[model samples]
Target: MGTFKIEGGHQLKGSIQPQGAKNEALQILCAVLLTPEVVTINNIPDIVDVNKLIKLLGNLGVKIEKIGKGSYTFQADEVDLEYLESDAFKVDGRGLRGSIMIVGPLLARFGKGYIPKPGGDKIGRRRLDTHFEGLINLGAKFRYSKEEQFYGVEADRLKGTYMLLEEASVTGTANIVMAAVLAEGQTTIYNAACEPYLQQLCKMLNRMGAKISGVGSNMLIIDGVESLGGTDHTMLPDMIEIGSWIGLAAMTKSELTIKNVSWNDLGIIPSVFRKLGITVEKQGDDIHIPAHTNGYEIQSFIDGSILTISDAPWPGFTPDLLSIVLVVATQARGSVLIHQKMFESRLFFVDKLIDMGAKIILCDPHRATVIGHDFKSTLKAMTMTSPDIRAGISLLIAALSAKGTSTIQNIEQIDRGYENIDERLRAIGAKIERVE
Candidate 1:
């Protein structure tokens, strides 16, 4: 575990770049296993979870080469199938939730995939039922062992078919798509997740010779292909990190410019912050948020009801950014209700903000009502432990605006997503130090 010692009440100034998308990197890294040819990827985020996946791929006998900064070529010419049943794999496979995605590609290519119970942030009940059911809907045989605590899927040959998912799970959809790309027939997936990450994965698969239509829509059609080849891919910028920076600038009265933020892909993120009365200026591909020393104000709905910010699927505000919204609202002029619909326990971290002198009502496990302090009362610094990745970043933003020095422990959760976060904040004039 590491700690971040931060001196608060400093107005940050200057530009910072958001790292490559963490979610997309996980999918793209798993996609490399679909093909035996060389697949080159750029803009890979240097984060803990992603590095763990890359190491797992290497251990699986995939030839990985770092061609440049944030660029790598993966060639899966040979894979050790026996490693999946090894003790070392059971430990490494459970390190992150994204590790489960490899099953689809492995099953598609080799007719078998195995994973121990994947472990990640305890945000909510993130079920793997969708992944297993989707694969089972195809020709795959799925089995689980309670004593061994592992899941295994095998198919002599996968035959694609039409199926409506129980939910439009992003990872589930990606897993199924990876499996279906090499099946015998056409696979039509309705109510599929159409996020940019999925769209990127579909495009990369298409570039690798798989025929997938409906790139940006809920309906996806994938035609079976014999084999996939190599292709070059570059990941989009981290939209969650961009939103985090926007909130950080407003809460800390900082003038910050986030460079190359991929404005088109950031659906409803900027507008959601604007609804909270935060100023977001678009300069081509960058976003510039001026200092907010005067404090931000929350806007009421058209009917004049209290503002309520909730998370939904794509084109809806991401559940990942709700924590940042909740933290930023602590300094706004009016009260707003943050409803984290996707995750149940994500709102529990508001107690830390309440301890910092912010007025927040934890209505339940899913929602929090934030009564903005309006900068009239300064938040007192305090020591806190980060509960998860998003909550950790939210606490970091709050600490940047606090009255005195603060320490945040268990920052490994934050490191699992953001790349060199302490160093990046320091480059933007934030008084943050990473202490071991």
Candidate 2:
């Protein structure tokens, strides 16, 4: 296992650019299978999960070429359908949760799709029912193998229909949209997730000759096309990483510039950070966070009630950044309640922060109450293990702001999402190093 050795209490300077959106890249990469023509994608982050999916595709006979740094050309002209039944595929497909998305595109273009039970973060139960259920609604036959823990969907040809999702799941919506684009007729999806990344996927499909409307709304209308052609696409900057950098700047009292952040697409992220008393200034397309030399104060409700930050669907604060917000609130001027509505065990990392001398109350599996020390007390460094991707970055931020050196084990979790994190942090004067 890889680890990170961080020297705490050092202020970071200079600028950092957010990598391509990890969530969007996963969806877009899967979409390449929908067409036989060449699909060139730019701004592909060099991360473990994304790379794993790329390798999986290559093993399935998709021709992949590296055009430049963070750029690739993929052509699924001769995909080997027989490879899906191999033992090698069962092991590779079980490595990451994103592999589940490939089923939709394969079932659309070809006649069958199969995947092993996908694996990802141990945060909580992320059911694959949404993905399979949506595909089943599109006239595909679904079957599960209990002994093997594998899922398969097959259809001679899919016919479009209307579906109201049980939940506004981002991956679920993306999977359904990809399948519906090649169905027989019009498909209407209500209660669809309207996240920026999903919207990007819809737009990219449209450019690829799929008829899709309501690009940025909850109701999506997709008209089946006979075949889709390849198109060029560039992914947006990862908003979650941008949010993390903002919290890191505030926690360490640093002046940092986050360049090329799509300001308009970052719905409610800046405002939520502002509620926590952090300065998120806009400089054209970039975000400039000034040093919080005197610490930040949380804002109360108009009725003078305590502030509570919760996650919801689009246009609401993202649940992925709640860990970063929780870590930042530790040194703020007042108290705030972080309610992680989507995942249950994300708040379990608070005990590690508490060990570092931060006053935090684990209200339950879903919520945490942080009493800020207002920087009057600095967190003492300690050794810890990363629980997940977001929690790992949150712990790294906490270590960077603590009083002494700290060690974080299982940094591979952090590497899955953030591209070249330690190297990027070092460019901004952060004292972070990667060690085996």
Candidate 3:
């Protein structure tokens, strides 16, 4: 396993550019299978999970070409449907959580789609029922193999229908949208996830000849097209990563500028960080975070109640950044409660921070109360293991701000999301190195 050796208490300078959104890249990469024409995608982050999906597509006979750094052209005209039944596919498909998305496009274009039980972060139970259930609602026959833990869907031609999702799942919405774009009639999805990532997928499909409306709303209307054509698409900056950088700057008392951050799409990220007493200044499209030399103070409610930051559907704070917020609150001037509503196990990483001398109360599996040391007490460095992608980055941020050196094992978790993170941190005067 790879590890990161970080020298803590060093202030980072200069600016860092957020990579392409990992969540959006996964959805957009799966959309390439919806068309036979050449689909050129730019700003593809060179990360493990995205690369794994790209390789999985190539193995399935999608012709992939590297046009430039963070750019790729894919053509799925000759996809080998037979490969889905092979043992190699079972192993390849199991490696990525995003591989489940390919089933929607394959079932829409071809007659069948199969996938092994996809694997990803061990945060909690991320059920695939949403994906399969949405596909089943689109006239696809769904079957599961208990012995093999594999899922398969087949249909002659999908007929569109209205669906009100039980939960506003981002991947579920994206998967259903991809399948509905090629269905026989109009498909209306209510209570859908309206995150910018899903909006990007809808827009990209529209550009490729799919009729989709309600670009940034909870309800989406997709009219089935006979076939989709190819088009160029660029991914937006990763808001989660941008939020991480903001937290990192505040925690380490650094002046770092995050460039090209698509301010309008950031939703409540900046405001949430500001609630924790961090300065998130807007410089055109970039975010400039000044050094918090005196530490930041958490804001209270208008009624003078303690601040509670929770994750919800779009327009609310993202669950992925809650870990970063928890870590940043460790050194803030006041207290804040981080409620992770989506995932149950994400708050388990607080013990590691507590080991580092941060006053954190693990309220439960879903919530954590952080009593900010206010920089009067620096976190002492310690060795730790990364449990998941967001937690890993949060730990890395904690390590960077702690006193003395720290070691983080299983950095592959971090690499799965951030591209060249250590190298990128080094560019901004951060003392981080990758150790094999």
Candidate 4:
């Protein structure tokens, strides 16, 4: 496993362009199976998850051409159905939950799809009920083996219908949309996850001839068509990364410029950050942080009371970045409550920060009250292991902003999200190095 050795207490300067959204790119890659013609995709992230998905596609007989750096042409015109039954496919399928999306397109195009239990962050009970529930609404039958941990899906001309999802699941929504776009008749998805990633998926499907409305809201209306034509599209910039950079620039007092950020797509991020006293400047599609004067202050209520930051469904604060926000608040002033309503174990990493001398109260599994920047004189470095992707990056941010050196093992977790993180931080004057 590769590890990152970071020397803390440094100001990061220089501009870093955000990579394509890893979440969106993964689904887009799966959407290549919707058509048999060549589909060109641009702004692909050079990350581990994307690489695995590409390999999975190539195994299924899709032709991938490197038209240019960070650009590719995909043709699933000759996809072999037998490849779906291979152990190689299932092994890679177990790598991430995003792989579950292939079941929809393959079933739509070839009448059958096979997938193992999807794998991703072990944050909490992330159920596939939404995906299966939505697929069932379209007349697809699911067969699975609890012992073998395998799933087989088959259908002949899926018929769409109105369905209400149990919860707003991101991948579940994308998978259902992928399946519904090729099914016959119209499919109206209520309580849909209309996050930017899902919106990008909708736009891509619309470009490919699927009728979808309510791009940024909870209710999504999709008109199922007989086929989807191949089209060229670029994945949007990673807003989650942009938010992380905003948090990092504020905490470390770095004058960093995040380029190519879709500023208009930041629906609730800016307001969310401003509540924490972080001002983001829009410099022509770029977000600049002017060393965030006075670091970050936890803004309280009108009557001088601490505030609570929590997560909800779409149009609300994202649950993924709450860990980063919690970590950043540790370095800010005042006490604030972090209610991670989505995941149970996400905030468990705060104990590591407390070991580093930060003041915090772990109210329970899902809630914590943090009293910030009590100026624990110094944070001594230690050897630690990464838990998950977001929490891993949060720990990295905390370590970088702390004093002394720290060694973080299992950087593969962080690699799943952030691209060339160590190199990027090094360019921004951070004392960080990656070693195998």
Candidate 5:
């Protein structure tokens, strides 16, 4: 119900820090349920989805203490398992997709798990089949209630085994890993999601006494342990946010330095932006995007064909960032086709950019071809509603570089991922105001 009034055409400068990775934090927070000991996590982002997950944990009787800013210690020694069946639990659990991750740990530790159908961005068909199948392979009985719209898994004792997932589902892999960490035998997962988020989760679980190997590869091996201990974990910077900043800087022709980006972990992201002809430089741990005053140009492939940017599984370009990439392409010198393969409906946001005077053709639900204006036309301000998290940020970037005032409604979608976005952008010389 909130809106952002952003006056465009401001040249933003100076450095800004990316928040903790929301996707990683979701998995890591759910891992707290694996151990009865105190688990302290730092660099937690203050975003709506993350906070909702934290509250959900508290509701499940995980003792949560906010030790400091962006830090929390959770001890789940006294959990209320029965609360999982309550109406309140269903309401909270259905609010965010990350809430579904708790099922893995709950089943691992308590031998039972329950989750209502999860909710998240309406980008595409995100299935829970991978999660349930992985658990079922690990000797857990799965049940789905059509009338109740809930999923429940139970087992007298889970026996771990090998499971090659249908796809390298990120959240699904994390869930299965958590469940396997406390099972009775060894478990092997092939074709797993080896993204930084999952890698960090595996590393943290190992530190907490979970016998896990293959931290950065698609195959993971886990041996069930009797118990887990307290551990400390720090999240990597949000790569999606970092990519958005790079797009924002390029679109507005501003010099920006994104701090503490963990450049080694940002595989293929910087290069992906550079392919769009944006100058991305590494300054120690920070990423420096120089102003594109003369405008950037999209580089064609070696065959002299039009550039095409598409998303893939790990190590490939992430689907979450195609929206930002699509928006940044609007100002580049050449045309590029943005293919969001994973999500069926994500490309629909191109209409809003088309309204802003960009030449874009939505080929289908998953593809869009953008012919960059190359600074020939300034995008005019307009009122728009944000459909999802990534689209909202992309629109915000377009608004910042637009010709006049732009109003973005449904900013709550934006807040679900970005932490204090308006305030942070203001610190860097952007004219943005948040109104209720």
Candidate 6:
């Protein structure tokens, strides 16, 4: 097992840069197989989830080359679809929610797609119904075996049509977009997820000759084409990481600056943190966090009452970031309720925070209320095991703000998203040591 021992209470004082987004890289990599030309992806995240996806693409006969740090040149022109039927594909597919996206691209190109169940954060049901329904709406046939729990999709030629997704599932929206990119006629997707990650995917597809409208909106329209040629595209900087950095800095009273952050893309994030009383200065592309020698005051509601920080679909605060926000809220002055509407089991980790002297009420599986200490009571750190990717990083933030040293086990969960997380934090003077 891998673990990270971090000594807390030291102010993070330095500049750090975010790696390319993990979610965007995963989607772009799968989209690579849709083209026959060389796809040069720059600023890709070198995280475990991406590594697993790269390996899966390699096994499928995609020629992958490491062009530079966090960059890759992928050539999936000769990908043998047969590899998708193998156990190796199923095993790799089980580790990521985005793996379900590959089926759409594979089916669009090869007329067939095969895979076992996809696995990721066990947050909730996370149904693939919308994804399958979208594909099925586009003239695709599906066959599933209950015993094997595997699915296969085939289509002679995908014909695009209008689709109203059951939910605005991020990966589901991405999957349908990939499948529709090569389908015949126009495809319109409503109730779409317009997150930054999905917008990047749309731009990447457009670079490859797919006509997609509504890049950052709930309605997406795609005009299918004969074939897509590859193009060089850079992955977006991870907003989630930036949010985590903001949380960590605020919780520890750190003087930190995150450089090269895509500020325009960070919609609603700034306002969301403002609710927590964290003041962030945008100096061009960098975000500045002054040392809160006097801790920031959490603002209450209209009647000077308590507030709740919850999550909804995109355009709302992301659920992937609620954990980090929750941990940061623990250090704020006022109390707030974190209602994790999307995932029923995401708030279970509050017990660990409560154990660390945090005033947290795990009201249920989906909701928790945190009473901030206002940096008065010192949090005594202890050994913790990471549960999910976002929760794992949130725990790291908590551990970094605690008074004593803490150990976080199962770094693979952490590795699935953040790129060079330890090194990046260390650059900002975080006392973290990785142990195997």
Tens-digit lDDT track of model 3 for 1-436:
9999999999989999999999999999999999999999999999999999999999999999999999999999999999999999999999999998999999999978999999999999898887888999999998999999999999999999999999999999999999999999999999999999999999999999999999899999998999999999999999999999999999999999999999999999999999998889999999999988999999999999999999999988899999999999999988998999999988998999999999998988998899999999999999999999999999999999999999999999999999999999999998988989
lDDT of each: 0.94, 0.96, 0.95, 0.86, 0.95, 0.89
lDDT of 1 by residue, 1-436 (tens): 7999999999999999999999999999999999999999999999999999999999999999999999999999999999999999999999989999999999999999999999989998999999999999888998999987899999988998999998889999999999999999999999899999999999999999999999999999999999999999999999999999999999999999999999999999999999999999999999999998798899999999999999998978899999999999998999999989998988888889999999999999998899998999988899999989999999999999998999999999999999999999999888999999
How far is 195's C-alpha from truth in model 3 (Å)? 0.6
For candidate 1, list the clashing residue pairs, or say none: none
Ten contiguous residues with the weakest lDDT in model 2: 123-132
Note the residue pairs that clash in candidate 3: none
* Candidate with the larger lDDT of 3 and 4: 3
Write the residue-wise lDDT of candidate 4 on 1-436 in tens digits. 9999989888888898888999899889999999988899999988888888898889889999998878999999999998788888778889877788898889888888889988888798877888887888899898898987998878988997999988998888898888988888888999899888889888988998888888888888888888888899998998889889988887787898999899877778878778887778889989888886566778998998789999887788888889888887887768889999989988888888888777889999999998888334545577778889988988888888888899999999999888888888888888988999
Candidate 2: tens digits of C-alpha lDDT, residues 324-424: 99999999989999999999988999999999999999989999999999999999999999999999999999999998999999999999999999999
On the 0 to 100 scale, the lDDT of residue 430 in model 6 is 89
Q: Flag the better candidate by lDDT, 2 or 4.
A: 2
The regions of model 5 sitting more than 4 angstroms off are none
Clashing pairs in 6: none
Clashes of 2: 0
Candidate 6, residues 175-271: lDDT per residue as tens digits? 8999999999999999999998999999989989999999999999999998999899998899899998898889999888999999988888878
Cα error, residue 84 of model 4, in Å, equals: 1.7
Off by over 4 Å in 6: none
Q: Score candidate 3 by TM-score against the native.
A: 0.99
lDDT by residue (375-433, candidate 5, tens digit) is 88989899999999999999999999998999999999999999999999999999999
Candidate 3 lDDT (Cα, 0 to 1): 0.95
